[model samples]
Target: MRTILFAALSAAVSTSALAQAEDPNLWLEDIEGQRAIAQVKQWNAATEASLTTMPGFEERRARALKLLNDPNQIATPDEVMGDLVANHWVDADHKRGLWRVSPLSAYLAGKPVWRTLIDVDALGKAEGKSWVWHGANCLPPEYQRCLVSLSPGGSDADVVREFDLAAGKFVEGGFTVPESKNSVTWADRDTLLVAMAEGEGTVTRSGYARIVKEWKRGTPWSAATKVAEASESDIGISPFAVMDGDIRRVAISRNVGFYAARVSMRAPDGHWVELPIPETAIFDAVVSGQAIARLVESLGQLKPGSVVAFDIAQMLSGQKPEPALVMEPTKSQAIEEVAATDNVLWVKALDDVSGKLFALRRQPDGSWSSKAMPLLDHSTVHIAGTADKQDIAFAAVEGMLSPTTLMSVDSTGKAATIQALPAQFDASKFSVDQRFATSKDGTRVPYFLVRRKGDSRPTGALIHAYGGFRAAQTPTYLTAQPYRSGPLGLFWVEQGGAFVLANIRGGGEYGPAWHQAALREKRQNSFDDLEAVARDLIRTGVARKDGVAISGRSNGGVLVGAAMTQHPELYSAVIAGSPLLDMKRYSHLLAGASWVDEYGDPDKPGDWAFLSNYSPYQNVRPGVRYPPTFFYLSTKDDRVHPGHARKMAARLSADGNRIYFHEYMEGGHSVGADRSEDAMRAALLWAFLTKEIGSGAD
Candidate 1:
């Protein structure tokens, strides 16, 4: 049956003979199939044996472990629940994590008397499940009750259980959602707006909850009242509740596309009222009584990337509220995050790829006043958590050379450091420099370089980028992962190697225009931009011509995959992790349907025309001298199917190309579930890089 299905899928992939070629490794897509698991184990063993045998591999692994297990690292607040700040902490002792909380006042001081609410490792042992902490949605006001989400094996699908925060225990006979990619929001003390995987017709094609029900206390899930439903073709529906001072408003966001959603609020009469706004407009947060939304497309007189505030009272009254612009970024600016406190809206943005924060407040006469937040210069500021009842927020500020420092901020924009992480690496010995590379379209692509001070000679370097999904690659501490953050100083830079962060097109660094430049048929621009950065690194004496490597995961994985296939001569090594390689079959895979808005649908003729051109799997040639590539993927990665890495690796090896494949059994889309696993992967990556490019100083 599986074989017949596989053959049918192959035939339906494309009408063209090239794409109609039968896939020999289709069985690998079965995920949990015995054959697939055996093959993954064999590859894992081979890759581990080969990489771990390298000189200094154990030492590097130990160093990474020490850094990852550092107890002095700041426990950044994940959320503010009433007067307590909640943080999920993971260390050598608590590998899974400890969902703990501390008084905001005590946390603001240097010492925090943390009370562990959920010991994830202990819970996992008690339940005999490898549970990973998803997060907790605590009820506002007193915040005594919370819905705790726990994922088995680190997959996106998780089981939700209600917990009593005051008692630090799971509430008996309380609400519980079965394992699925579900969402549960507290509508009141005894009511919940939940989107769960009940049975057939409950989940969308993208494997998310398509129906949302209002579940009440002491009742079966089936007895819950249906409040909202989205079409199966839609991405999914998520119910969210916002607390506006003393009032609570419930809304359902029907995600029609990845970046598009239609939000409707439940009126007092129990009818859903759709908000009169563009589907592309992001409903950021509700501050006071105003709904804040960030425009992705031009709406009326407001331009794209404009943050606007709308009065909620007018919308609830069946009237279209005129949006007042809170702030509009310049051409060189990009809004990163929009967070709200009780009375203030904090906009974290980037100016020419440098971090800048602003505080906007709605004034009398329906006007808005904005003021730049007093933050450290040349550092990235991320809002850790924001208080709902108080005009207080916490942000973590860090840079390429600076360790992360947690700060508490007031409505007046005054920020005071709460805790600072000790330097994990010798940052004083390194310097960060921003450079520009002219791309094929005459566009200037900005990239950051982290290298030893006073070193100008060509050396081995790694160019990292994620040029999709409007995600901006920002500067972080050395202990940060390079896949998301810009660089890894301890593993690469501290080892006398230069690390390059390519802020190419398709990223939010420069705003929506920057990302749109690399969309659809223009996706090649991201590849061109990446290659230009690699060449620029060589031309500027930052990296040896034959020693540059490129690495990215997921979207960035597609970037490097295209880079190696399109411009193989520019890079010596390529590391693609959990990538989307077979564009022809991506949409048919799990959750791939939701991303068609980002990457064009391959089933469509015109879209496939462009996707096929740069698809690494389809573009592979018999005799081309491609760079040595390493492919790592998680078997539990239900998001970006592991088949992408499997088939790509299989195809490359079949073509007699040098390739290494490692498929981890756990850690759905991420490197691992714990810090130790993350450290091991980092060490393995460094081993491969060093082996390919020769230890830094040439």
Candidate 2:
């Protein structure tokens, strides 16, 4: 009977071939799916109608995109490093910051070596020029050399110019190609393997989806020969080594689903052999000689969070393959980090409830060790590891306060502190605590509370969360300092205020199980979880409901919109940033199709039944007393369309609700006007929140 029910659901929700080919949400074919599409169309029409005549709206948006695409506006290597150091590591002892855009620089003998960079900022702002850095092979090397991709500033062309880092001069042996290229890895001193997107007309129908193209180290810039072409949905390179001579094996995914297959290259004619996995659904895979490790999901199980291992040599050599489930699917064992070394594959697994590191180890014969790393008592753990499998680092440990400590455990079992914040912000007076509350179904949810010590006043509190996409809302020192130093100090704590980080169910904080529990038809779980956090804060007397303001970006924006409609009396103000409010048309919208895995397909009937019930745009009825809200979006948001925000604001405004809409003409998906622009926006958000939530006046 259960099987029959699942089959019925699957059939009803399955997408059409044409839809699947054009839209990522092809799996959602039920009645709810149709409604979702209809709602999106309605929202788009409303948004276009409202903004068509707005003075400079179109121009501003175009200007923003141009700025983003302008090479001069891009951050230099030094600027990128400084930003990372400033925002990521706030500790007084360490000098390193969180590495963004560029992955961790490759290190040899305890020194920095090579690094890669993309021209896009963390907020998806275009840097204009893309580049990579290669350093001396010497011990404790000097990284004074760089190869920069330089095209005419605003032209959408691909050109690379090699620059001598020390002399600040461009070398004559530079190259240019027709297609933009990235993910360049040095095979030898003279050979490069890069990921390229070529022959682009419409990527969905284009023959070149994503391919690995090789380049000779000293060769002039010319058309690249495709090493491998990926299917439309499947993308990602296998974690393999180029160290042992040739490119031994490559991992490729044929479908958008989470499954990967290995293609190995052997000598004696150099033919590529493909080993297919019939039963496993893998998202990522890494190969280390004879051993292969992969992140696998159980068939038909929404929350099969596990990592499996196989003997690569045995599989490729046509021997009886010994497939072992390296990491078993645990409700609590959420895989946070995984990497491959010469002989060992390292895995970092976390337990959901305590935000604690459960285990870190190398696969096969390596020992599994467990330690409770001291995290900021209220911050979520965000872990990042090196590409070469030598170091493992984590940011935003609870209780540290001011800045995050970049602590790395080396291959020799030695833990060293690499980087931290400079001594600018004081960390002595703050305190954070974790609290839990019971949801509507009696499910216990957790949230983080942060405030200054020695304050007992009924301060204003800002409760924030992003309860979708299995994206965890972890604690970090970046945004907290602004609040802590300003309104947070003057209003929340000094003037008596508080800050809350809600760990709602839709987030991966609790693992894939936590996310699956809150998906599709059960989407209400996220709302309930968030409400539970709010109630817990109120019950604890941390802040009254009327003094609380809720803020979230992207999918979290959807949460804010839904909350305002469902329980308007809970929050005094709502700040929805780049939200997808018109859920009915989310799949049909930009980048909306990619999110069907998180949110059920709206075109399908069964999905529609559940989606329409809580879709914030659909739920907004006439004559309801809604809380004052702020809507912010970007005109160049190629990911989540700005229409979501525009339409929501129009409907609310027409209905006589107080809604402040600020559409950034540029800045891509982030809507950050610039560094200075972001500062002003932050100030506005604080001021608005303070005024609405009754924070201490300046």
Candidate 3:
């Protein structure tokens, strides 16, 4: 039976892939595969009458299908870009407002520009439109703003907009160039470092790129010249600068394990000097005087086990100084964030087991003193943190039951509230708890479980997990609170339902080490961690296996997909949003090549063997009893190709599984159609969850 089912699904997928061949892009092919899969699943379902259906399932599914198909539900390219900027940033200023960028465009006098701006105040309240601000640097003065103005409508060309806060309006100053392919950072008001693709290759194969050229402020549009190039096999140019008294030294980083090259002014001429640091996937670095501090993940290693501060100042002066290991790895702790000022090295140690934050300061004598800071234990989760010599500011999200607050701690050991949500949000009835589940490896993963206070009915549960990319899934006090509160009147809480956030291994919650445990070759560790969490909940009688539902987006979508395929018995329903199902082709897809360091290059012989072991799309078996699932993808998602979700759903549906597929034509990577449309999507999702997980509206 399983063989028969598999054959049918494969046949459908092949037909769909062929239909989509009109678009040569791999994305079109994936979409076609999805259509075929859906057809197969539907045919199979027609033959099976034993599949259970929830009350109002057909009606709710119809409504969802209609909302997804409605033209008004789709977001324009501009709206999609705005959502991307808003959710991508963790800094205080970036999180507080709604951000929008014009579609990609070019200015004739200026360089190809993408108008990137943010309105500092509009979030959550507005449907589609948020607060708006033109080109301006949010950071303090002396920082250069690399602004791009997108041409009206979606265009390939853009006018690079350079704005000096000191002078105001967008100026025609600076060199012109094609649209950027990588992130651009500003160094001072005059120089800009942009990432340009110099080469390409297959998804799992290696490639090359150069970081050459520095666009100096006031320089003519045509004068851009090569400043540096990445070595062969290295694909990125990370631009950084260090300020020392009156001089500024520019640094360029390259390779899989980012090695540093320092360019400093030496009287008549400046020369480039390479710094010595072990080969590792360096995320970021800070250079000051003779000291170079970096956050590095050792090559082929999971966690950034060492925080090294090397004295390259003496090296620049023709002397060699030994590098100091400022912070060494502990059993379960890894460096989360680090900064150096004066002579002290301030580091944040993320304790994996407790999901707690620890502050460690290296004194002038090089001794480390560590203290545990109060966990921002509200419904609002911690998004990002910034630190300097005198103080540190961390942004956190409280749930819809609580206001999002930005808190700070000064050198004086005094903690102060810097900012709070401006809109009135009620947080009286909800409570949040951070708990741990033991994974198969004996690794305890932390999770934040939230529900209404005094609601102990042991009702259904919604378990969410995103354990990839070393991204931390913190708490947020937003619409989730209201949704959990029985807003649709489904009343999961009233039914005694609870929400569980599984902090599986592949996340930053436990610092880099936690992420390393689940990356690439050890990818199965994440799945094991997630499965353990589900079992723990069941074993503890907190929630029954049949009463639970799972949801995730992007990498999290991969998590859900894996769960559905591998352990369908654990969940009654699954929602995979904007998921990357075809791991085999992920790296070759849009912007996927850049993530090789995270997911491993699929092209390599060794890596391919490991990646294929869990490639969700390739591993889907025929005739397997999978849970009912709702799949969503956006047509405008230029990031993770929507074909993953579309094809996966189609395949499952065609295989006779209860599946619902919704494709939003214009929502980009984040699947919300528009402002109002997004809210409606949220409503539909909640509605689907309640119908699937909640008991009748008693």
Q: lDDT winner among the candidates? A: 1
Cα lDDT for residue 148, candidate 3? 39
**Model 3: per-residue Cα lDDT over 333-437, one tens digit each:** 655555433333445555543333445554566445656556454333342444332334343435434555555544334555544545332345556677778
- Candidate with better TM-score, 2 vs 3: 3
TM-score against truth, every candidate: 0.96, 0.69, 0.72
lDDT: worst 10-residue window of model 2: 1-10
Query: CA lDDT, every prediction?
Result: 0.82, 0.51, 0.52
Ordered list by TM-score, greatest first: 1, 3, 2
lDDT of 3 at 58: 45
lDDT of 2 at 602: 86
Q: Taking the candidates one at a time, how many backbone clashes does each contain?
A: 0, 42, 60
Better of 1 and 3 by lDDT: 1
What would you estimate as the lDDT of candidate 3? 0.52
Lowest summed lDDT across 10 adjacent residues in model 3 is found at 1-10
User: In angstroms, how far off is 200's CA in candidate 3?
Assistant: 7.4
Per-residue C-alpha lDDT of model 1 across residues 601-653, encoded as one tens digit per residue: 99899999999999878888888888889888787777888888887887788
